[model samples]
Target: MTDEQQAVCEEVLAGPRSRLPAPLRAWLFRPELARRGQSLGAYARYGTCLAPHLSELAILVTARFWGSEYEWHAHKTEALKAGVPPAAIDAIEADAVPDLEDQQSRCVHDLVRELYASRTLSEESYRRGEAILGRDGMIDLVAIAGYYSFVAMTLNVFDIGVPEGAERPFGRGKARAEAL
Candidate 1:
């Protein structure tokens, strides 16, 4: 591990949990739901419902774009089990155009690309997304992305290392993988 990563790991482990000041603990190791004021149970329920409707390729693409190893690692297995094809996973990892065969998948791909590229949806992109996802669905999609982006930032800032025996979900280079 890099020096910074090693230091972060040490700090997280060494920091007093019960005895530390509440504000300090919040700053150093902010729990995801605490930051959002939502329970983990609620978030999981929302995620589970949305995951099936979203294109797996889009989710993978977003994870890669954000350089979120935690997001990528968690969702990679989930996507596969949810029936996302191996080729699509490879395409997402390689940053290549995915050959998604369905309309829902295509719409999601477009939405993810637009969201990442512009930080706002274009007229055409918004229209397409609205049509495919409907108003509430579109809102949910954006929320999901926002939620995961927050997670990505947390994982990076806290230097949450991948679990033992877990494949490095980010690309090969250490610097590039950690940049985000």
Candidate 2:
């Protein structure tokens, strides 16, 4: 790796987590894009007004919806650690609606699910999201989807894989092929 590449890797490692993620490493091929992408990523995933649990849930849903295995595998643990209910994660893994107690979780799941399906938010969804999250939270929610979608695509294009022996959450299968 070039000195510049090493520098970028170090910068990412210096963040909250120590390990350099596969997606970020893949983005290293284009250092400028990676820097900007990681900056937006930090803000989108961490700077959002939504609770970590909610944001992590939304990210996992996005990963599953798009059948991005690397993304799913990356966030599943974080989502769980951030307090996303196990049942919710299980339901989303199987493409079922989770019986969540939190209104925000349900709202975020609804918003992201619809957004992935239609590439646009419906009026009812917008109103519901706005009511629950307000305008800023709603905007941040959508921004997370858009930004993570970019990240997911980068992973897919690069065929970034989980560490050896790790269980693949969104592996290629009939379900994965049909996701979409």
Candidate 3:
């Protein structure tokens, strides 16, 4: 691992809540905790919330878009446990088009694709998304993406290595060495 990655790994394992500079630690922890709290809050308000609503396929796509091995590694099991079809999970990891046969699954594919590709929704995409998810669901979808994007960035920036005994999220091929 690179020096930077090693440092990140140490910090993450140590706990971002504890490792943050003393002055900022409290605020950072509050917001981090609240983000999770609010996710739960939103779920409570809506009968079926966050993970179930967003679906594993969408989460996997977001993981791949950010090249976040950690997120992918973590979520792969969640996806499986949540009953996400294996084929869909495999397609997302491979960065291939999802073979969803239903409108709901297709909607997720479209939303994730548009968000990752442009970071902005086109009018048509927005309308279709709204039709399926309604306004609140749409907002939640964006939140999920935004929240996970932050996660992916943190993992990448810190070069947080995958836990031992975990399967490699990026498949069996080793990443090409960076040229100096």
> What are the runs in model 2 whose C-alpha is more than 4 Å off?
173-180
User: Candidate 3 — which residues are off by over 4 angstroms?
Assistant: 1-53, 171-180
For each candidate, what TM-score against the reference? 0.71, 0.91, 0.68
Residue clash pairs of candidate 3: none
**Candidate ordering by TM-score (highest first):** 2, 1, 3
> Model 2's lDDT to the true fold?
0.83
On residues 61-177, what C-alpha lDDT tens digit does candidate 1 reach at each position? 777887767667867886888777788888888777778887777787778877988999989888988898787768767766665666566556655545556777675334334
User: Relative to the unseen true structure, what is the C-alpha lDDT of residue 126 in candidate 3, on a scale of 0 to 100?
Assistant: 95
Best by TM-score: 2
Error of 1 at 68 (Å): 1.3
RMSD of 3: 8.2
lDDT of 2 by residue, 1-180 (tens): 888788887787787656766677677888877777777887897788999999998999888887788788889999999999889899999989988898998999999999998989989989999999999999999899999899888777666655557787766632323222
- The C-alpha lDDT values of all candidates are 0.61, 0.83, 0.64
Which regions of candidate 1 fall more than 4 Å away from where they truly are?
A: 1-41, 44-56, 172-180
Sum up the clashes in candidate 3.
0
User: Where's the lowest-lDDT run of ten residues in candidate 1?
Assistant: 17-26
